[model samples]
Target: MELLQSADLYRRAADRIPGGVHSNTRARAPHPIYFERADGAFLYDADGNRYLDFVLGNGAIILGHGHPKVQAAVQAVLSQGLTTGSETRLGVEAAERLLQQVPTAEMVRFANSGTEAVMHALELARSATGRTRVAKAEGAYHGWDSAMYVSAWPDLAKAGSADAPAPVLTHQGADAEISRRTLVLPFNDVAATRRLIEEHAQELAAVVVEPVMMDIGYIEATREYIDELRALTSRYGIVFIFDELLTGFRVAPGGAQEYYGVTPDLSTFGKAIANGYPVAAVAGRREFMEQARPGGPCAWVGTFNAHAVSMAAMCATLQTFEGGGVWRTLQERMSYLEERFAQRAAERGVQVTLRGRGGNFHWYFTDADVRDYRSAATSSAERYRKFAENAAARGIWLAAGTLSHHSLTIQHEEDHLDAFVGCL
Candidate 1:
């Protein structure tokens, strides 16, 4: 239970880095565990302890750590040099495979991160619609840019009515123009969303959302809500964007749009597509995607955009996902885990609910149905934090964030899962 090496490394890191960790999500209370390496579904920390990795690189390592296919693809491209600042065959294959899988995406462009993908998607929406404002779900984590950084995890005290929630900015002191332009809509409320969209129809260029709000718990948008958004956006000529950063390939082969049978003008993807490779994409219908062309209204240029190595890795991951069995397998395994957790919680007389789709999941401390951000937030944060702490003590590395959801890799076998349950 001693994180001696991890503690020492963190002490040094804190001297140089603002936080001992790179990502804000990794800024755990005492210290973040620094892992030496990961193999399959196990993470070996600097303290030399092996733990079943439920974090799954924040849902990015769908095939698991050090997947042979992805590793081989990456290795194959290393000899060809990293970035040529020109096009290559691997890049073409990656884009073609993405468009083929996502039927709604007639064309696609690549980026290095989910945040950049979301930013570019919104810019494309604005250029195509010639509008200034955009609307997003109240608690969804689209990105961290000024425009998309509002209302992700706002204090309920300041958040306005459920009918028309205010856009609460994440940063304290900053320009307020971004907040003023961003509109917040109550997630999972079709009537309220419709009213806001209609009222601001002319000025609203885009309506961005996560089909499943995985950050706050695996809270899903009702089918009726999605249907309503599509209808409203179509009527108003507003660009609809699905920010599938966490849910893209994990939720289904195509994503939430494919799973729900809904279509959006644009969608952003990252995480699972490349199986841990640093690559993200903005995909959508030709009318919208074409705006990013050479002299078009939207600009799209990047030195490492679809660098050959990452594209090669993405192509291999997509090839593995070509057969429909991966999705089915992920669903079956997660459902089994949910069943076990439910039985265990019942035996302990604990009120809880497990929610997920694809392979992502979360267990709330409350038994009531968690259909949206507010209900999910009401779950016992203290209990969840304690559970994560206990799980870490028992050699199961769950995410340290209070409301963060967890996901398993495809490589996690029955024995690994049973060990998790045994620890619980």
Candidate 2:
């Protein structure tokens, strides 16, 4: 657990990388452990230390690491050729598979990441509707883009009032114009969202949101809340968009849209789509997506869009999910973990809370149920952080923060859950 080699690697990486890691999420306390390799539900650090990986690459590794099918697919594609700019048979297969699986995706276009996909979907909505303003749910992490980056992790002072939250720029270079063009609304507040949309109906282009708010403790939207948005958007002629970057293939094969029984005009998908590969997709009605008109004004083009290797991996991964009963097994595992955590907390005279369903969820060291971002913010960050550090030390790896989700790769074994809960 000392992880000497990991410490050395981090020290060297810090000298060159901005945070000693490529992404902020990976740069947690005690230095980010340098991973040597991963296979099936476990990760080996630079010190050769093994861990039962609940993080599962932040819910992207649905079937676990080094999945034979995905690995073989990538290797087969690489053995022949690896290129991003050219159209290939694997790309066609990936798109067909995605369109078949995703509920609202009649046609699909590819991008490099969730940020790009979300940006493209927003632009498409605006172009189709001829509107400029876009509304996004508060505390959602679409990506590091200007449109959705506003109010991602706002500080306490400038976060504004809870009901009508002001969009605070997390980065320095963000221009004031982006905030002016964007409207921020609280999640799960169906009435508030309806009022906001009606107020901005004429100028609004789209209402983009995550069906399941994973970044803030995996909070789920009520059925009434989802129905309200869908009805309002349709009545107002506003585009509805579900940003399923995190929940795409993790929650259900058809994504949250299918699970929640709500349909959006447009949707953006990523993360587990390509099994952690740097790939994402924007899909929707033909008319809506036509704004990116092949010969028209708006253009959503990228060099690495639907790269061969990523396509192969995605196709292979999707095939695996459809053929195998992965989600069923995952649902059962999460249920057991939730019950065990609750029992352990009660026994220890400590209060622990669990939220979300199926493969993704959050564990909080509080008695109250967290319904939204504001509610989640009041939880014991100090205790959760300490628990994460201890869990990682005890050969269990999870998302390194107070708020995060569980991947389906977690062990369903009773003793493992008992040991984990008892440890706390």
Candidate 3:
């Protein structure tokens, strides 16, 4: 309950680290708690208080924290060296494993982070299609790439219209000029998206979206929307890019594309793909992927792109997923958690609007069903902040906002599930 040690550490951390964290999102308040270690579904803080972690490294650790398979794989490559300038069989095997699971990907190349994956994917789209403009969903989180970052969690005030969104940068010092190259689309709006895509079909290089959106409170794409979007992009010779950084492997073995029975032209994979390791991938059909090869279209250059350790971790995680047991368990556990969440909300007479499938979820603190940023913006952030503060006191670490999404791991045992319901 007491974060006294963490409070003191934050004071020191704030003086040195910008915002007391490496990534701005780690600044989880009411005061950031420093972690000493993590195992299974629990995190041991600097103050030695153990918390049932629902964040799970922002939905990357699908196999759970410090998982034995991932650990041993990482450790095996540790003695082999951190990274080699050239290629490894492990990297080749990792991509093979990924392609086996994902039906959309005929070929793939590794990267270090989700942003890098998205950036390269966008570049491929532009180069392959010979178009300059890109389109993305209004509320989706596709990492922090300048072109893709537009309209991701934009302030509604500046976010123009719900049906036809204007590009609003999520960060300061973001290239204002990039806004001219980026276009925004509404979530779950098949008609509006079709209209916009057709309107800019000539200039549109790609339509980047998340099948299961996480940043805007986990809004999912309707089947109709996804199917129509794919058709529209194909009709116009534009690339259909799915940013599955948070959804890949976790939503299903083949990800949202497999889950929704849709295939995209190109997609970015990370997060759960490495089970918390620093690895990502841009994968697609042969023609598009080959463009990154040699003398094709785009330039592919990154010294540490295929770190052996991370690739091994990815291989181990994906191999484990190949058995298909973990995904079934994830569905069962997520369903139970949803039931408990709703039960407790009903008990307290709280009006909670929930949206989730598989392991990803969020409980919007409002009565309205939310589909996009404009509708989701109505949720009460203030109430969620207080709830987060109280949950932290009781050894539960929820993500900072009501609208922010969280995930479950296979490691969350019955006790963890019960405690989660109790916290609710």
Instruction: Give the top-scoring candidate (TM-score).
Output: 1
lDDT of 1: 0.87
Query: What local lDDT does model 3 show for residue 36?
Result: 93
TM-score, candidate 2, is 0.95
TM-score versus the correct structure, for each prediction: 0.97, 0.95, 0.96
**lDDT (Cα atoms) of all candidates against the true structure:** 0.87, 0.81, 0.85
Ordered from best to worst lDDT, the candidate numbers read 1, 3, 2
Candidate 1 clashing pairs, residues 3+ apart or interchain: none
Window of ten residues with lowest summed lDDT in model 1: 415-424
Off by over 4 Å in 2: 410-419
lDDT of 3 by residue, 1-424 (tens): 6788999999999989998998787886666889999998989998899988989888888888999999999899988875767889998999889889886789999999999999999899888989888998887778777888788777888878778988888777667788647889988988888898899899999999888888766787888999999899999999999989888876777888988889899999998888899999999888899889887779989988888888899999998887789998888888888888888889988777555766888878877767777778888888677677767778898887667888889988767877866654
Task: Give the higher-lDDT candidate: 1 or 2.
Answer: 1
Task: Return the lDDT, model 3, position 156.
Answer: 84
Off by over 4 Å in 1: none
Q: Candidate 2, residues 293-389: lDDT per residue as tens digits?
A: 6887578778898898899999998887784377777777778878877777778777778755657778777666676777777779888887877
lDDT of residue 80 for candidate 2: 91
Model 2: which ten-residue window has the lowest total lDDT?
A: 410-419
Sorted on TM-score, highest at the top, how do the candidates line up? 1, 3, 2
